[model samples]
Target chain A: MKRKYFQRKFDIRTYECDFKGQLHPLALFNFMQELASTHADRLGFSVQKLMQQKMTWVLSRLHLKINKPLRWGETLTGRTWPSGRVGKYALRDFQFFNQTGETTAVGTSSWMVIDLEKRQPLKLDQLFTSDVSLKKRALADDFPALPEIDNSENQCKFAVRFSDLDLNRHVNPVSYIAWALESLPEPVLFRHYPMEVEVSYRKEVFLGDQVICKLQQIQGTESLSYIHKLFLEKNGQEIARLRTLWK
Target chain B: MKRKYFQRKFDIRTYECDFKGQLHPLALFNFMQELASTHADRLGFSVQKLMQQKMTWVLSRLHLKINKPLRWGETLTGRTWPSGRVGKYALRDFQFFNQTGETTAVGTSSWMVIDLEKRQPLKLDQLFTSDVSLKKRALADDFPALPEIDNSENQCKFAVRFSDLDLNRHVNPVSYIAWALESLPEPVLFRHYPMEVEVSYRKEVFLGDQVICKLQQIQGTESLSYIHKLFLEKNGQEIARLRTLWK
Candidate 1:
């Protein structure tokens, strides 16, 4: 059934590159949004129509690992599917492949239905049913585990700038990777691919707040599977912790 | 100095919007990148030279505020400046204004100088230092403060998808706002003339982890804000938190 959903291809544009001349992580999210929205449309549901009904789907969580870096003008394909559904929540997966079909990155997302009018959560039965199936095979087995952190000795600091906020009036999660990765030397970061990352949010960061990010390398094989923790700290207080894996 | 850094205005493009047809926050970051890079060239320091010298300026942190939603095909002036320098870091500022000089968004970023080859931090003395007196004076002073989050109750959760990750190999911050805002009813989000937001990064979100975002109304004001926390429960333990503010 997953095969029913069409695979989409995209080309990275020049504008998407950072000073280092690589595709920005946020841009990839934009592409995935397009792919998911298009896939939903193909499955007989339109995000627009959902909005009209005061019903929206929110992404609840995500886990990703990148094996190599992608550059500008590179052609890539984002293969996505609705792997399964649990009650009102739906499980979707995506695989990013280079032109040669080698997997560059793999990810999964869980979405839930919301009632926009009441601004409240809605049951899956209230929105979608078992019939809304897109019988695609799961992307892969052996999904990496979430990174482990001590939660102690985590002291990463950052200042929330005006540009870090998004239209929803919050800091975007993808920006966190940039900040965390930025802490590393550019040469190591540029040469190494992000093997895996698991990010969990605890608090919201506001403008002018000095944000603190803390990290600890847990365990890994060939750096492709190392664990790390991230969080924001203010005046020695813990805000959030992100456990991540990198290759 | 701000006046000197301000160049001719550039119009916002339609391609910048996400599925919700609103300007993606990261688009603004990209604009800032373009404006700053161009401004850097004007200041006689091209990205190429910076790279060659093994000295690169990384965006250590950022905070952003959006006062109004920008629509498709809207023309706005993007003004940027090197507000000041602190040791090996330079503080850059950006403002988006409409034709009437009405500010739409204001942003600030802290950048650090790194030795790309040695993969080490560079001291301010090792890099060029000129009194940014002219640029500092040219910067606008009356920028708005970052938006605040009102409550933590009634939060929404989202999962970062594969597309959410960019070439930078992590979730893009702008995608977080796009996803969070898209979760809202379209009519309410699109109709308002003036919308304000402030976002900070606490942790990095990757594909497959669940992110919980909470939105609440500010008291005695028409304004609203949200707290986004991205996390996953394996053995029933919390992972990460991402917070955001929107009005």
Candidate 2:
């Protein structure tokens, strides 16, 4: 039987770290995405393979929890596996470990198979029947609808660049989190580090598009959370919404 | 004797590639920077070591030529070495090779040792005496001054985000090029690929700073060239200028 899991090791580059010498959240997300793609390719379900059938994968939502902050020059092993399915969504889970084999982060993500021509979600069971370890889940929480931001305290505008587009021709999902983080207040950004992040992608963003990120903060007894909403500047269409917790 | 040259191998990640499935220029630059830092660390001249002595290395200029475009999922070996010192500037060079050992890209960069407190350039001879093979140069051309943009044609404004800053608490040099590329015509960006790029960094950009990138095209006899200037939006301080040849 084909192995249901994939593992890849990565060395943290200096450019991947922030001023605090810790790995930036965006870099971590990039690593996860890379691992997921590689695994999908190994399973004969790569984007190219799906494209041949006029179907492509679209990330719907992701929830990541970082147990420890990864630092520069540290080598980490990323392990990912297919984690069953829910309705039209395909579930994947990821775990990141440090050099000493400590779990640094764990993530659960939901993706949808989409018909490129019709621009609609396709049923997963028809196209995706790969072996998934239904019992193994990195994160215990199921994919839930995130709360909306009550008020926006800060915001930033961004013009999508060519570099922001990936091989799929749409804006890379990691860029959304990068812009969301940028919309936070200076004190919140520099004083704290993100320990958890949940992102829900609503619409596709392309090159030459202008987007604005709106940030709203919520204070809790245990942790501080911020909700970020990214919207198309031209039509006010929602692109993505993210909730991040800092400590 | 310590090895003067450092070599590292990297697997191009899926996220690092563009719509063409070729590695992005910014990713190539990031790989070069990572290789350079690793080499410096091995030579006991890392940024941390320099910071201990109240000094730091600042990139002054760089010229990179891509003989062939690198593609996603390909393994490339990057080799970098300290070439020599020219007056107050220390010269380093880089060469990238594909799995077949074909030279894919080459770059030469100039750096200066800066006194952190005084913000002054220090003499290369005073603090740096590392073994450098003066004869080994990746590129034959001397570090030439990059041309300034004549007239602003396309422009984009950006606010420095925390993610843009590296461990040095300043904007990574690669981000400057990313912004410069964003300030170009869509046809030029999507149709042509940059074959050669030269950049001269004039001023440092920090967090919360707003900057604007202005692009100017220069039609040459054989090739099309574009000049990009990134300036501080508040005071109009020229941060960096880049010249790129696209084919």
Candidate 3:
């Protein structure tokens, strides 16, 4: 039987830490992204091959809950597998484990196969068939609905640059996460860290484009949850929305 | 006899690329940094151990020349070793090799032992000593002097964020390189990629400090070289200087 999951072990680098002395969200998301890419490639759905067909995987949603922030020099393993599909979107899940084989973090993501020529999502048959045999979900959770953020307390503009792009020439998901995290107030940033996040993508950000990020509290002061909304500074069209559960 | 050099093998990640389908300078510097730290740990002078003694290795300068930019999925190895001591600074060198052992790039850096509480420089004695059994320099290179960036055409301010810091809580070298790259205009960024860089650190940047990056072309229209000078936006105190050779 073909294995339903793939594991990649890595040692957290010193540069991957943040001001609070733990793993940066960028690093965590990057590892999960890397694992997904590698697993897809090994299963004959590599990004390069898909690009030849003018198709690419676009992350549509992500829900992650970090149990513990990894420390520098610590060894951790990321295991990811396909968690079935929902219509045109391909679902995947990830688990982070320490050297002792205990899970330390978990994440789930939804992706759409976008065709370059049509500028739309392609069907699962058009791309490549996923391993239907594997039916595992890392989280026993559902997609959280986005809370309306009526008024934003703070907003910042970002002009995408060369460093913001990837081999796909698109701004990767981790960049958006970094931008959202950076937009938060220093007090909020230092006071608490995000234990869970639900992100939804509505549009693509290209190089040289100016985008604005607005941050505000989603619910009341009862539970710490903030909503981050991103839009094009030119047209103010909503591009992405994210809600964070701060611990 | 003690081993004098350490080599780590890895492939470039998708998040590490820029506009072109090649590796970003920040990613290259990061891998080199990881190798050096790992080597130090194996030699019994790891950061954690040094921190117990209230001492840490601070990167003072780094000079790197890239013959080619690595592509995603290309396997590469980073080999680094101590070259000797340069007064209060410890000298080290690095080389990036392809899977076939062909050298793709090279770099050199100097580090200073700093007393954390005292906020002062310390001699190499305080930190555990390196093995003197081997004395081999990776390249016949010397530190480059700071270029004269008298009047800069482009200037941008970067407020040190939680993501910009490292385990040492100071802004890392790669963050400075990223800031300099981001400060360039789109035309200049897409037109030229850096082939060589020599960086010098004068002062430390802390959290919430807005550091100004001033960029200008050095020399004439002959060989492309640019100078990036960083300082506090408010106090105008010099922080770091970087000279880049463009291809």
Candidate 4:
């Protein structure tokens, strides 16, 4: 029988933690991505395996909700499983829990297989037919589409460095999340912690590329929210959009 | 008998690897930092313990020699131990090996204890005495001082992002190395791999700080060398210096 889920244990390293000694959100995303890749590998669809067929998985969207902070030196158990397909997108869900077994975060991601040479998305049905639980999901709610920011109060520009590239030779998706958060106000960044984050990746970025990040804040009754948009500076192409809720 | 050394095991995550699927030097530094911190913690000199005493350990200088490239999904065993005091500086040594027991890297680092309130360095003798291997050294050669780069051929500027800060609320030391390498030529970065690196931390950088990295290349008969200097863009204060040998 094939395993329906995969779980891995992680010990939070000191460098992976923030000023509060808690695991940074980027580290959490790395953990989730690792777990998901391992699960996919077990099902014979890893990046290495896919590369043999001139195809690779691209993370198009992800939504993560942090319920509790994972602290340094703490052990985190991350679990992920396939949640079947949604049109041309392959869906995966993740859950993170501390050693005490309390849920720390839940995340859902959408992926698409792309032809490496052609740079075009491939239909999920033609490539994968893994046994997925169509009804199981770490997050039950569907993510609302994040709108592009037009009138932005804060902006930051970044030149993609060599360190930003991963195995795909493109800027790692987590850097986009970091750039989005970097454009927020100092008060919002220092005074509040992000509780929920939704990201939609529209284009790929490469080394030596320049990008601009724009952010707009929205004050809510209970918490503060921000809309972030990242664009390629060369052609004004929107590379990614993000929505973050903080408390 | 007092324990003289500490060891830890790690599995390289996918995100930690580069385009060639080999572990990045930055990730290696993170692992080394984590292992060193854990050793200090085990010996009752961790960051938490020092912070409670209104003091903290500051890394002053480090020299690393890489013998082999660690790849994704491989198991790495890291070992570190105190090498006693060198004047006002306390020294530590590190060695990393793969599962097959081949040495992958060796490093030596100097650290100083600083009074947090006054931002003053304290004498090593003032700290509690701990038994260390004074004769054992990971790398026998003492690091030569890196000179400032006057006529730099390449330059890059970066604003300290929120993600760059660690528990000390200062830009983590690894970012300094990354910034130094970011100024190198693209061919040197992609065609060759760094074999040896030496860094000296002259000052601390905080959020909202803008820093400029300058690099000068030296062509040698056997290999290529780079001299890097990082300065505060606001005041031109030199923050760090580095020398990297690549093959």
Best by DockQ: 2
Model 1 residue B175 CA deviation (Å) reads 17
Whichever of 2 and 3 has more lDDT, that candidate is: 2
TM-score, ranked from best to worst: 2, 4, 3, 1
Models 1 onward score TM values of 0.49, 0.97, 0.92, 0.97
lDDT (tens digit, per residue) of candidate 2 on B134-211: 568999767777766667778888888788887678998999988887787888889988889889999999997999
Name every residue pair that clashes in candidate 2.
none
lDDT of 2 by residue, A1-247 (tens): 7788999899999988888889888888999899999999988889888988888899999889999998888999999998888888888999999988999999999999899999999987777565455568999768677778877888789888788887678998898988887887888888999999999999999987999998888766578888899999999999999999999
> What are the per-residue Cα lDDT tens digits for candidate 4 across A166-230?
77889999989989888888877788788898999999999979999988876545678889989
Query: After aligning candidate 3 to the native by TM-score, how far in Å is the CA of A20 from where it should be?
Result: 4.6
Relative to the true structure, how large is the alpha-carbon lDDT of every model?
Answer: 0.58, 0.88, 0.82, 0.87
DockQ of each: 0.05, 0.85, 0.64, 0.84
- Report the C-alpha lDDT of model 1 over B70-90, residue by residue, as the tens digit: 765577788877787666667
The TM-score of candidate 3 is 0.92
Candidate 3 lDDT, tens digit per residue, B103-131?
Answer: 98998889888898997888775454544
> What does candidate 1's lDDT look like per residue over A208-227, in tens digits?
46665555555444443322
Model 4 misses residue B200 by how many Å? 1.1
